[model samples]
Target: MRHTLKTLLLCLLLPSAQVLAEEVQVAVAANFTAPMQVIAAAFEQDTGHQVKASFGSTGQLYAQITHGAPFDVFLAADDSTPAKLESEGATLGGSRFTYATGALALWSAQPDLVDHSGAVLRSDRFQHLAIANPKTAPYGMAATQVMAAQGLLEQLTPRLVEGQSIGQAYQFVASGNAELGFVALSQVYRDGQLSNGSAWLVPAELHDPIHQDAVILSKAAANPAATALVDYLRGERAAKIIRSFGYQL
Candidate 1:
């Protein structure tokens, strides 16, 4: 009876060990937090592989990866980060792919404060505008482009309160630190609809496309869990979820 019990215990332990070995560590862009969380859950459910995630500004993540962060994959807010990693041989060649195109939105906590026609930008209805720090966040780059396209950059510069990441930028507006701010649309969407606040979806013509990309890190290229994650992101299911988050395919 003792021998039989030991055999059954070993059988159970073996599969648990295999499962533990299949886990992957992902470093994701802060802007991608919402969708990445949803996808990570689905990925684990479908594949029985765990995902450990860390979120931060893409620039910060780039610095960490360069210094040998143990992230198995990188989901960047822009293509440039992945490209840089690839050029530096930090990422597996040919594993880089544009996963989504992010959109910029001018949002306000007050219901009618943001004019879809972008007239509020010129109206001087409010005193402050917030945006992510262009030096670190891709959305900030797009925000600057939108401001410049509308000829508001110089005028708005003084009123601008810079957030280190898109999440912080959203907080500035939500907290009324700024009457209006440029933020990712995904941040304000809930249950397939825009939140109670008003927003203007900036036209793509206002800026270069915010192409978000993913790549398997060179250190994890041979890791089954890492490779699986890259493949999972490219799969149809993941793409659909990404699109639902207001990102373009």
Candidate 2:
């Protein structure tokens, strides 16, 4: 009789638990796509909350938010965008935090095309090099910074190809439209190693730190799932997943 009663209570409570689960709409920076995908899966499994992420360049995403896109949470590639949103009162106060530090990598689809020291940039072997648009992508800005620091920006300018976002820039290289390109280290790296192709991990000293931040938008101030997702990102499990994709916590 007790077993039957317990089984009946379990059946009654299961539907309530399912009903309590909520979905969070997230705007994520393109560079974080892989790790976010992994993290989102884990978050959903653990908390029963669903994450729906839209990926794009940070600047583009910020523009959408300012134009009233209905995103509950934003994970940006740079700290500035989130700060800008906060200053504009578009974000929930005290709900912002750095989630990752991004690194730049010069990548080529061909193996051994890029050397560890990135000497290929100074060479004339490649006709075109791709970079994301500096105006909208933090990685693209960092790529320019790296070139400038190496005194190759002016010389390489003629050979440059621009992409709307880092993902597109990477695609340019992968598709051989550009022989090489600057991309997020996370995109080419996984599990402590390069996933494929050849890459030169740009030294962090060549550019300003790319500190990625996450924030809860004002539109999601009342969203429990939004808050929960943000909290989950700060946890060790999420940190581990972020690190696996070559991002610094």
Q: TM-score per candidate, in order? A: 0.90, 0.91
Off by over 4 Å in 1: 1-20
TM-score of 1: 0.90
lDDT for predicted candidate 1 compared with the true structure: 0.90
Native RMSD of candidate 1 (Å) = 4.4
Clashing pairs in 2: none
Candidate 2 lDDT, tens digit per residue, 22-106? 8798999999999999999999999999899999999999999999998999999999999999999999999999999999999
Clashing pairs in 1: none
Among these predicted structures, which one has the highest TM-score?
2
Each model's Cα RMSD? 4.4, 6.6
Candidate 2 regions with alpha-carbon error over 4 angstroms? 1-21
